[model samples]
Target: MSTKASRAAARLMISPSVILLLGWMLIPLGMTLYFSVLRFNLLMPGDNPFVGFENYRYFLTDPGFTAAIWNTLALVLGVLVITIFGGILLALLLDQPMFGQGIVRILVIAPFFVMPTVSALVWKNMFLNPVNGLFAHLFTALGLQPYDFLSQAPLASIIGIVAWQWLPFATLILLTALQSLDSEQLEAAEMDGATPLSRFWYIMLPHLARAITVVILIQTIFLLSVFAEILVTTNGGPGYASTNLTYLIYVQSLLQYDVGMGSAGGVVAIILANIVAIFLMRMIGKNLEA
Candidate 1:
């Protein structure tokens, strides 16, 4: 077929999927946008009147909103720091020719496949529980009092749980990147009297920079919306201590039955998420160019 004819045929074949995808995305977004302006509450449903920016104002001015924003940022940053650093260390170890390498790698990445809710539940009841948890047992055996993780440090506990789930993903990515590193350069560095730390600092770490950025970008996107772990563990409780934007929206909409406020929060979250994504994308672009 001629080039123009082929191009036309390709467009014809892909048009349906493109239209469907657009509709799928745009429809809910349109509804959310529509609802965000109305004072629609489950308690008072009759004659929903339009209230332009009122919902946004209320949602933004909410006392929990600031705390939620801080918690969301802390959660994302804490998880990213842990996952990236831990992943790098784990990746280095996994890259070594160790016994049962394949099985070990599988075990390392196994946590990623586990459901977030399941992991949170395990962490909450089996490990962090102050009464009968493994940690409690260990503490008692060691003649120490068991620490209440979720209750005493809700945000930190959530961060640790989320970090555990994402660590494997970062490890897998960093390991793949590590595998592609030029070993000859490392050998040359060793021959040149380079120390292990020096080699890592000057060669390995630099080589893994792109993969690290990818991990951060991808993980940050999902980390912003981390809800399952929080819900299963803290329920955004201890007074919004672990309440990220997603959980805040859930409370506004489902718990409080304030659809308008929830929709407004959702919109704000989308804006903040896009802002972060765009910034990361630009950074990735710069890294790629480098």
Candidate 2:
């Protein structure tokens, strides 16, 4: 068979999967777009009239909308900052020859495998609880007051929880990148009496730029949709203090039963996410080219 015939045969084999994937994604999106332009509410069963942009107007004007957007951006940036810095420090430490190195790396990477809901629940009841929790116990031992993390500082607490979960992923990626670095370059720099900080700043960090960019791009996508952790912990509580965009959409759709408004919010979120993704893609493309 000619190369063209072989290519055609391969395309035919994969066409079913391509169609299935497209239908799976496009069908729900189409329905969401359809519902977003209507006055649909689960509470009101009858007279689901098309209201055009009314749903979008109401959703955008809602008070919670602004807070949710800010909270979403804060949560994403907070987690990214913590994970990148902490991951680099942990990666450098782990890359050094030490006793029980394998065990240490495994333990460090273990949290990334945990379910978000489970981790949030554990942190809520075990660590961040104001009473009878580990932090409370530690505080009492130190003659200080236990901090009411979820109640007083819900957003920050959520950021900490998310950062902890994602740190392992960043560390793993950075560690892989670090492991692939040329050892001779580092040895030569050290032989020339380059300080440790100088070596890291000049040699190591530049090598990990592409991996860091990759971690940011991938993590930002998932971080924008963070819901299970907030739902399990704060439920976007403390008066919308911890309500990220995803949780706000959930409240409108499921809790409030405002399906049209929720659908409109979903569309807005998709647009914002696409914008961020495009920006990150361009950044990564430039980094790759460099």
Candidate 3:
């Protein structure tokens, strides 16, 4: 076959799948954009009138919108901080020649496989419960007051739960990166009288920098849309305490049945996610060049 004919055949073979995927993504987005510009209420089957930008204006001015924005930022930052630091530390520890190392590695990575809902429920009811939880028992034993995590600090509680689920993933990534480091370089540094701290600071950290950035970027994407954990545990409150953008949109669309407002919020979320994706792509591109 000629080169052009082969290329044409390949394109024809792939076109159907590509077109299907595009439709799946673009069709809903188009509907959301259409809905965002209209004044449609689920409660009142009105003679629907298109009110351009009115839904966007209302969504922007709502008090919950501001709180949700802050909560989303806080959630992303909290997860990044907790998971990156904890993962790096655990990865370093597990890299050592410890007994039953394979078993320990499996156990360490097990939490990442858990369902978000299950993790949230376990944290909220079993671990963070004020009365019957392990923390409560420990508090009683220590002659201290029992602390209610969800009621007292819902955002922090959700952050902790999400962090627990993501930590294993970050650890495994960093650990794999660490394992691929050049051992001869480390030995040479040690021969030159580099202290353990100096070796890690000057060598290991630099080697793992790309991996760390990758963990941050990937986790940020997942963390931005954190819904299941919040829904299962805090339900976005004691009063907007844990209501990130995703949950805010869910409440608008499903609970309030305000499709127009929810679509506006959804557009805002897409913009935010795109901003993060741009930054992440730049970071990954730079890493690849290095």
Can you rank all candidates by lDDT, best first? Answer: 2, 1, 3
TM-score of each predicted structure versus truth: 0.95, 0.95, 0.95
Off by more than 4 A, model 3: 282-290
Residue pairs clashing, model 3: none
Q: Tens-digit lDDT track for model 1 on 134-154?
A: 999999999999999999999
Stretches of candidate 1 above 4 Å error?
280-290
Worst 10 residues of 2 by lDDT: 279-288
Task: Name the 10 consecutive residues with the lowest summed lDDT in model 3.
Answer: 39-48
- Deviation of model 1 at 187, angstroms: 1.2
**Candidate 1 pairs with clashing backbones:** none
Q: Cα RMSDs of all predictions? A: 2.0, 2.0, 1.8
lDDT (10s digit) by residue, model 2, range 1-290: 56998999999999999999999999999999999999999999988899999999998988899999999999999999999999999999999999999999999999999999899999999999999789999999999999999999999999999999999999999999999999999999999999999999999999999899889989999999999999989989989999999999999999999999999999999998998799788987886898
Candidates 1 and 2: which is better by lDDT? Answer: 2
Distance from true location, Cα of 259 in model 2, Å? 1.1
User: Could you give candidate 3's per-residue lDDT for residues 1-290 as a string of tens digits?
Assistant: 56998999999999999999999999999999999998877987986589999999999999899999999999999989999999989999999998999999999999999998888899888999999999999998999999998999899889888888999999999999999999999999999999999999999999999899889888988899999999989889988888999999999999998889999999999999998899899987886899
